[model samples]
Target: MDFLRHVKNILHTYWIGFVCLIYQVLWRPKELKDLQQHNGCVAIVTGGDGDIGMETVRALCRHGMHVIIGVKEETNGQSVEAAIKATCPFAKLDCLPLDLASFASIQKFVQQFKAKGLPLHVLVNNAGIMHAPFAPTASSSGSLESHLGINYLGHFVLTRLLLDMLKRSGTKERCARIVNVSSAVHAISTIDSIKEIQFSKFYCPYGAYGQSKLAVTLGTYELDRRLRDAEFPITVNCLHPGLADTNLFRHLSPVLQPVKNLCAWLGFMWTPSQGARTPVFLSLSEEVEHTSGKYFDNCQAVPSSPSSYDVRLQKELWNWSCEITQLPCDIQDEINIHYT
Candidate 1:
């Protein structure tokens, strides 16, 4: 049995490497040449303090966009600010407090952002927790699984609060973009009903993570559809950043952690920079300026799970998200009224 397990691990590692190699060979993203043109444009990146989120922030700053780094702690924000400045001295950056685990925090962050009177041109929903143990969000009052609350519900509220800003910032020259950093693991999720997602119910760490990621993708599709119907020049898309050795995997059991590390060392994983490629491309590349509601991998548009494209599921998820997040009735009506 032990030998069979070892062989299975070897096969898994090689398969990962094989897929990565194919993507690397086929999809090479080119850096936007006239990046300075984005100067003065504003971008807000959630969870931009470290990992792929930090790398995404770096790429945006280097292109001369004014970046707002959303972090839970001000000190972590300051550290990220200092780090970005060290390399891109011309980078215009601001670190603001944002906790994805709490709806109150998201509302407060939006208020503060609006007070700045800055137009929001890009939003990268890059903050997410993976394989978290059975727990509720910091508030816990809602009994929402931590991963679902933080990864999907938080971003849902954040985006709704800022929809006005994104709409106002759109133009033929620069259509506002929202890039959701999802994962390939979304394929594992088969969430059929809303009741199946409560934190008080049966929980599997990895399964919950997959469900949340799948929600991210569905949210992007619904947002895209609504924006198009409203004639709003905003694009929303999601992508699976190649497997990278980031801190999001810390929840792995001690027994499996070493195996994960071994896989990374054996060339099956990407560095944070490599993982940042698809997101940065989605955020900056002019090629996809009009692209919305699409799933991408390795910086290219690709088919996601068939379930992700189900229009009924998309609407169901959106409405449920609004209800769970406790969005105001009038606000929810206002947003939904635009849909056909």
Candidate 2:
């Protein structure tokens, strides 16, 4: 029975991979073009040094947007800067240090960004950790799991801190964008974990990762609602970049490494550039300019897991996040709408 279960799991994984490949072949994103609208626009991409993140930055730069690449270390940022300059000789790029695991670091990053008086037209919350050993972040609030703290809460706080800049851009362009990079694994999230997070012997790293990603979607929805209520033209959306061969799986146990390698050899994995298509589409695609609070896959709007749409869960997570981060829960009251 144990062997049979393992066989079933392997088959299911391959089946999903096969479907994603077919979908990509049939409905790939249109070739992105440079747009006059992106000239002098400022954007930030967290985890911009990673495979998919770097590709997203490259696409954004090719479109003429001035991009800030947020990396955890100065050296990584330097490397990214060098890479971008090699391809885009005239690209406007800045590499900044951002450590998402530490809230203090997040605050400092935001403050540094604001000190420059830069206008933020796009924010791509693309940095994340996956399936690592369970532990609290160095400065995580109240024993919050590291993955949740880094993957969701850190970006949550970063967005709030940069809200004014984003809102300001909306007034000028009639549209500013926030793109949260979630995952198809979000479908496995359980509301109970999000509402009352507790890790026990049954706790699985992948499960915690899913719950954190689900929070990302819920946060996107709640933020969209707040912006719309205030008549701000800022659009917030989330997406699942297809499974790709990347360093994200460095935490996989030794026993599973062979299986992962086999899958990669089978042509089932997406290249980083292919995985980036959906995020680039959501970030700058004109067709989606008026859209907000939507979940996307393969560069198209799609229904998220039903639980992701639950108002109760969304509110619960939002409030919980505010409480943990010590951000005021009444942010709606603080919004000063500049656009009618």
Worst 10 residues of 2 by lDDT: 331-340
- All-Cα superposition RMSD per candidate: 5.1, 4.7
TM-score of each: 0.88, 0.89
Q: Give lDDT tens digits, candidate 2, residues 250-280.
A: 9987997897787667656677888888889
- Poorly placed runs, candidate 1 (over 4 Å): 1-36, 328-340
Question: Which residue pairs show collisions in model 2?
Answer: none
Give the Cα error of residue 187 in candidate 1, in Å.
Answer: 0.2
Supply every candidate's count of residue pairs whose N, Cα or C atoms clash at under 3 angstroms: 0, 0
TM-score (C-alpha, index-matched) for candidate 2? 0.89
Shift of residue 113 alpha carbon in model 1, Å: 0.8
